[model samples]
Target: MNQTRRKRRPDPSLSRLDSLSPEMLFPAKSPSLTSSRIRYIFLLLTFCFIIYIIFSYGTTFRREQISSIARSLSVFSTRRRHLLFSIAASHDSWLRRSSYVRLWYSPESTRAVVFLDRGGLESDLTLPPVIVSKDVSRFPYNFPGGLRSAIRVARVVKETVDLGDKDVRWFVFGDDDTVFFVDNLVTVLSKYDHRKWYYVGSNSEFYDQNVRYSFDMAFGGGGFAISASLAKVLAKVLDSCLMRYSHMYGSDSRIFSCVAELGVTLTHEPGFHQIDVRGNIFGLLCAHPLSPLVSLHHLDAVDPFFPKRNRTESVAHLIGAASFDSARILQQSVCYDSLNTVTVSVVWGYAVQVYEGNKLLPDLLTLQKTFSTWRRGSGVQSNYMFSTREYPRDPCGRPLVFFLDSVGSDGTEGTWSNYNLHRVGNCHRAEAVERLERVRVLSRKLKHDVEQMVAPRRQCCDISSPYNKSMVINIRQCMPDELIAMNT
Candidate 1:
């Protein structure tokens, strides 16, 4: 015992258990280990986020690039792009034989909204919602006769601005009689930027008041394009400017006056024809200027472009030639005097015209006939100058001439030697040569331009790619090759 009894040796297992500490059973956590695990998790999440961004951005870039390519290749776009047609129609005229029938069937109908007079909404229960003048209290002033229509101009500008769809780059205004080449319209608009204010249309000098109001005023009957930015500016300030131009002759003049304040000038495009005369427009369309044929106004007064043909036939005939090679057809088929009193009808590219002045062959050749032939061996050789170099003068002014295609034994077509044997008048020949040279230069330039438009180099997206049904049809009609390639 304390005895001095020696303590028994402790059991080894019991001793070990008793000696164990809390620190040995459960180890303390390391700060570095916890931080390493957190770092691994953060890296994984960042990698996933980066992958998502790449996928999204890559898809968008590819799509944008493809669309740009498509637009650049074709003259007309498939997307209903660029124009908002504002049609001016009277309540009585909307359902009339001359207006509604043509308007309903037109490609512009869907994009167009008819602006009618007060109480016009109630006239026909079947009609769609139309804009009326009475509602626009902003520019509330009226005048007599045709001038009363000017009030609607301010209202249309205001309402269209209020609508404010950025996609609508142009605000096109026209009378009900106007026949639009919607495809040509988009093609024309593609040439300009809508961000800058622009007033695009043609002028009319048939009326005395046209020059009196402003020489720059665009004839509304022929239709006009107001750039979206310019339209917005007009919407805001037009009401204020109306009072100053109250005495203006027509809506076109009023609009001209308003835009002039903002330093916007008219961009005259001759393709838009205001054919004020009442007759057949076959001659006019055939001889249309170098620009894309935009519209033919006063259709109600004139016979259709192809009077004998129906809608389908006439459209087919006009579509391709009108969009791509209008100038070529014009040069070949159209023959008219300066007074427009004498016109030749060239059917299937063959016709003959006999003009008479007081004396012999007249020097005034308004629409001269063009003929071309290549030399047998020379590449791209033309005998046009030789054939037109001399003209035999008859006392009775009877000069029998071959008009079209002729071939020689040497496999050369249109050789100058095959036609005229006699040499006579110098003045007429010199005049003809000068005219031919001018036409030749114009033709070369046109061909170059058309080639550039149809098969342009693949470049970065410069213009917008918008679509419309009408535009699609036009593009198909005009530039089928590009359209096919784009889809493929």
Candidate 2:
């Protein structure tokens, strides 16, 4: 086996492989392909960083923007200087109706212009400046028994906007005879956003009138408001819109149609009173809605506000009371004295009703039918917009009445209003309430914020035991969980 062993030579292929360089085993790629791959990786990393940033800080940025907007809005609360009034009137009625305007108009503070059919009148410092309406002869009218002057009245909206008043927030429209509680008007308008479109007012009290015209229409006599933003747009398109609504009967109807064309509807406020009724309005004034009294219309059609005073004097009396505390005017408050079995309802700055037994608050809030219907008819025609209870024809069945005698401040944030007993029918009254000859109500001036105006709650009142032929009542905010009911 040893003699057979022999050495063999290496193969030619193996010797060639061992001699090759290191570059042959690992090769390099082109520069273009390598550069493209690097760029793709960089782009993906940058996109992920951007998405993380947005998720971390986007909500904070949005919150800061909203805060800035709210601060700007708070700086400009509505004031008397923010309103511009355009009163529609005629030369024939101006002399008589101007008196009504003077009652509420303040030469120094109120900004108003009376739009008359004709100009050329003696200048009076007591009245607002007068402007003759632009001729509206071109507009068409097809309604039977309707006046063409409605076109002129409707045009007042355009003419007022053209005046170019600076810093005006609201443009208010009213009839010459309409009486507005300006302070209360300002309070109500402050609750709305003037930057948006708004149409604020009320309809007629009579159901028939609403059916005859439109339940959605805001009666012009009651007065109405247009936000400055909406007024500008409405003024531009009113003429063309008037051409389309030529068949409408009243000026308010024309304005309503034009506003409707813009996709806006009436924003009803119960404070505006059309007073579409006849005879005494005692019941209406006594049971006013739980809101500030904004405006009153049709003073000539109804009896004087007070029993003995003339029409103008009666209105002046109410206005005098309003001058002290307009926000509380006509606000009704009910309370009961359980020990004496007596119930009393106080209409601040207006009147007072004293009942014998424990009367429910809901029953006292209903309107008493002391006045007749707006139209002479039966059934639906005589119906009213609100709930009403029949006023007793026999004086003996009625409660004791008291009318506002005077009102004044209490030298602080508080104020006092005095009411004198209005002697009526010689009816036998309950022992607890018969001797009451006067009522003195003590309250603080109402200053409501936006939240309170949005969701108003009825105030609570406490009555002091009757003393020396007089009674005292203190009105205050209700306590949490308090109920207005007779004590068990």
Candidate 3:
């Protein structure tokens, strides 16, 4: 009883968290500190909730910034590739391995011959890197003298093949963007009995000096195929004439010039179109010959990495698109950075458009991209502008929204017409995106092809392209009395 009396009297008025019992420590309501404690707890909880809200929003905002940064970095990587090559000053054994170079065809054996513009051969080849390190200025053909550029390329093709690379029966002025329908081409070509009358798409048309050369048989606009004998004949003609007129602007004109010099007639076939520009119907694949024709000169979407159809998807619902029965060929250029000559990496053209209820309505008329611009530095750069049909944009905001592109290059026109606004917004908001779901799925697929190109080097000498496995008969064997008019 004496010990119990001493422990009870310590602190009944004093409030301590540790001193409190099970019920008294945190009672639902108590006379001492109950009201004040409830108010303090409410304030503390409100502050914590505010902090959590701020942290959550801040985390979301940071994630968006990081995503935007990644996109920007990817875009910037393309621009910096030249810079990387510039800094890397080594022509090591790796580059010289020949395996590093794709299309491992023995230049001697392969039928493909490239004829690029050759104005800068001498100046360019003498540099540290025999090939261009950056955007070649007056490059491609850097051989001495202004030699129509194509000749230099032809010579390289000839020399490479001559050096025991591969056996070539036919010669094609193959373009970069053109993807061959090898199966159809070889099959159709095998069936042909006469080579005298060359076969091009029977429905092709050509225009020269305001005179339209519409053919019932075929039209040859871009690259065309020729027998080795025809190639020799053309080579001889170029040998006789190129030294005399090396400064001519048009390479295609040079082809006509060679024909004119040799007095050789050209036969046309739908298969030998510039590519996606024109073709015919009936006894072939797709009968619908589009506004853009096809041949050696191919018109693919913008980038192989991101193929977006530059023009209107469908001509339906347009006010006057039905009038576009016949195709019109216009030589357009997109000047990325120039004044005198437009830099056309991809083949394309500009079409004017008007939007009507989510439809990208296009005008049938062909418009050209003017290679001219307002000056920024010392040099007057080419203005990258396309002619518009009826562009209704803000007069002060963006001025005009136009689609512009070039020929034989991946014809990626710059216009928001093809863009599905809601779809793009969804892309921006999506947590994760699939490439196949985007507008440029084809482009992504094409870009992926670059990996295949740069992958394992094929042996040039043994390189028979399985990609174009056709009637790979010897040129001499194919040469009967009727084919290519060769008696031998």
Q: Give the range where candidate 3 is weakest over 10 consecutive residues by summed lDDT.
A: 80-89
Error of 3 at 118 (Å): 12
Report per-prediction Cα RMSD to one decimal: 19.1, 14.9, 28.4
Q: What lDDT does the true structure give each of the candidates?
A: 0.49, 0.89, 0.29
Those runs of model 1 whose alpha carbons end farther than 4 Å from true positions after fitting are 1-79, 97-110, 118-129, 134-147, 205-209, 307-488
TM-score of each: 0.51, 0.85, 0.30
Cα misplacement distance, residue 10 of candidate 3 (Å): 99
Worst 10 residues of 1 by lDDT: 467-476
Per-residue CA lDDT of model 1 for 1-488, tens digit only, reads 35567788988877686577534433447533454655676698899999888777777797998898875654333223567777776667655523332423245333555677754344432333466645544554555455565677546766766766657778888776676666666666766767678899987524433434555877888889998878987888877777776665567777778888989889987667666554444334433444666776765665544434544344444443433333223332222332312222221111122232221122312222221221133453332211122222352343312222211122331111111112224325212121221010011112314454445331110111121110000001223333111111
Q: TM-score of predicted model 2?
A: 0.85
Q: For residue 114, give model 1's deviation from the true position in Å.
A: 1.7
- lDDT by residue (81-139, candidate 2, tens digit) is 89999999999999888899999999999999999999889989998999999989989
The local distance difference test score of model 2 is 0.89
